[model samples]
Target: MVSSRIVDYHEDLVEEPEVELPQMVFADGEEPVGVRVLTYQSSRAINTILNALNEAEIQYLRESSFGKLIEIAEKPAFSGRFARYLLSRQLKVEKKHEAWFRFAGNPIRFSLREFAIVTGLPCGEIPKKQKMKKKNINEKPYWPELFGSMEEMRVSQAVKMLRKKTVTDPDIRMKLACLAIVSSVLLSTNLKMKMLKEYAELLGDIEEFLSFPWGRIAFDMLMTSIKKRDEISLSQDTIALKGFALALQLVIVEAVPALTEVVQDACSSSESESDDDEIESPVSKARRKTLNPAHAREVDRKSEVNIIFN
Candidate 1:
């Protein structure tokens, strides 16, 4: 009976072992922190310790000041895990990633790449380097090659070339001269009186001269001659001539709207010309080529022309 009882007691002890509850240790003065009890098994006591450690870590993160938080983040003991958690919480709650970035001396020490690695978040792509375009030698005019021999050219030849380049079609020139005269009369009191006196001397009746279109044309032609004289005065390179050019430019500004209107009217009037009858001069063709493709097409369709007559 004693032998049977011993065997039965040994079997019962092997079947069930007594479990001891984990005790959390604290300092002599400090109170013990709370922990979640999962299983009664001693093997699961490690999980309780882990839970206490996690709580301690979270408490450190929460109670600490900004400087202390940075100190804790720099510690290798946490392996950046606490730093990432703190930053993630900050991003979620405050929607401010720049604070941490600013603290880290962003772009230099703590770049987007570092931020991405710490947070396990997607990073922004680096900007691609822009390739500089090579300038077209054929497109640009060589100023030296074109104007280098101008000093050696004859005065008459130079004058002829200048006139050819500066002056437009005869009709356009006349229109611009008319516009300039009208602008001068409106803008200058002295010019207006001079024009009135010239008209009175030539026609004997200034009102009749102004009423007639042909008289207006004659008056504009006379004013144009006066402007040409002023332009000739500019050849001396005097300070007064410079002031005169400035004054003339100011006067011309007043005429721009009228000039634009006259040109548009001329374009409208010439719109009915037959394609076969229209002669495309070299200057006009070059001008057309310089225009934007859409504008060029519009010009071709509308028979509209743009000329620099001034």
Candidate 2:
């Protein structure tokens, strides 16, 4: 794992590596912005949000070279029948950033907590203040009505009602059913990393951190909790491991820059300490192959940093 000190150094702009490659290869006039997501987020949530925003006819700019959520938000010449919007979009995920909505824009900074309420997840464990602001969803979605005619019931009860053979307990069943419908709503986005050798160490480090973080813990808890009640078991670890393995395979092929630098430094010092008087036997001399002019030129052409990236 990358130490907090190392991450802090990068964040503080104390040690920026000199990157020569084109910055993410975006087109001219393009820029990136960071967007923060809320808890219980999923890719479908992102799609739904985008769909709503797009339907509302807003214009925006892409804040990331990659990232699906950011890419769609930033596409050029994308206008709606209503308005012309121009702003950047991208998701900023750090272990420390809590679940909330943060827009990199003026006017009002939207929070995911607010977004959840807007999306009608009012009964899904939000603060009392946020819950008080719930819109008149009475005319909104009513998959809730099918579960049963109930008042003051738990989500578990609603879920039980939906899954049972018949209408056993209407009140308890209705609540659980409502819970199921509400929980099924989409709320976030994700971009699967591309497989490549140059990202090996970065991938490895992220995996190490996320395994013990919310990524793994939340999934584990949700899966375990649901299985006993619904008779539907999902092995999150198995899924996580599969994803980790694919990511690892790509990152493992890339040389770790820090490790390589240490090795090169050691090699240089050892060579520098060696004396010119060092000698080899006649048999050893005969075993050493002579370098051709082309080979010598090739050796001189390689840069240390270039070698590392390769």
Candidate 3:
């Protein structure tokens, strides 16, 4: 059996021992020269070469006899601009690759310099180019095995969008909250396609309906939730309704803490402003004087006016 060990070999190749510090040399009368150390290893360093080449999806061929490796570079048939953009946005690799490969092989140069410039990876450290193989265009989307419960998918989709910073908009946030509540209710009641469709339709009647993108995200979240928990049956409709009610209650319940925080913040800000105004208020000083007056006559007169007004 062939055995292989992965290791870093570059740290082992230093040759010079430590030397004492050099005294300063006068450079006024001397010519200065600069030298750069360029290092390339032969094919004998197969493991090291393989590791370096394996840094990305790019491919390479090794020649042991010649002690050299040749990296094969090719331009993807499609425009890499959109692919690069999506990649920069950190989309899934499959999505990025699929988008790129959809563009057939047009004659384009695969520039490592451009790749480094685009991706911000070191120019010299770029890996070999791999063939961009197109996937089946008609492949049907199905639930993955990892999330066996469909409800998990639903909940998770909402979470994913929130993670993507989609819930920043108030409208989106509210819709997502509503969708979450609905999905939880549906899942709890063991509603499948028919009920799910009706729920979506009812959502349309809601004045501030979520956009298609957000709705899809909400749907995905519902599916995901079911997938995760591995439970989707509503053995008792009453219990399911209770679960649905609980889910809605949870979203509503969050608003209490949120509103409280907002109110507290507003109060604190108002108090701070009042404190700032107090520092320069002559009116406030005069008011304090009236409050602190020690004269019995003045106090009695003010009391008499209060009683007469009453």
> Runs in model 2 with CA error above 4 Å?
1-28, 31-88, 91-108, 116-165, 186-310
Each candidate structure's count of clashing pairs: 0, 21, 27
Model 1: lDDT to the true structure:
0.22
**Candidates ranked by TM-score:** 2, 3, 1
Off by over 4 Å in 1: 1-210, 214-232, 237-310
TM-score of each prediction: 0.14, 0.20, 0.18
Tens digits of per-residue lDDT, candidate 1, 183-249, equal 2222122211111212222122323222333322322332342223221232222211100111121
What are the per-residue Cα lDDT tens digits for candidate 3 across 1-310? 0022111111212243243222212111221221111111111112222222222211212221111112210101111111121111111112111111100111111122222222221223212221113324774222222123443344335534444454465444434434433343222333221113223432422342321222223323322322232112211111111121111111111211221121111121111111212112122222110011122123323322221100
Residue 124 displacement in candidate 1 (angstroms):
74
Candidate 3 stretches with Cα past 4 Å from truth are 1-153, 167-169, 185-187, 190-197, 208-310
Per residue, candidate 2 scores C-alpha lDDT tens digits across 1-310 of 1111110112222354452222211222342221111112221222222332222122221221112223322211111100001112112223232211111110111222222222222213323332324545663333334322432343233332333424554333323222222232221111211111111112223322112222232233332322232111111111111111111111211221221121111121111111211111122222111112233223323334221211
Global fold similarity of model 2 (TM-score): 0.20
Candidate 1, RMSD to the unseen true structure? 44.1
Query: What is the overall TM-score of model 3 with all chains considered together?
Result: 0.18
Candidate that beats the other on TM-score, 1 or 2, i.e. the better one: 2
Superior candidate under TM-score, 1 versus 3: 3
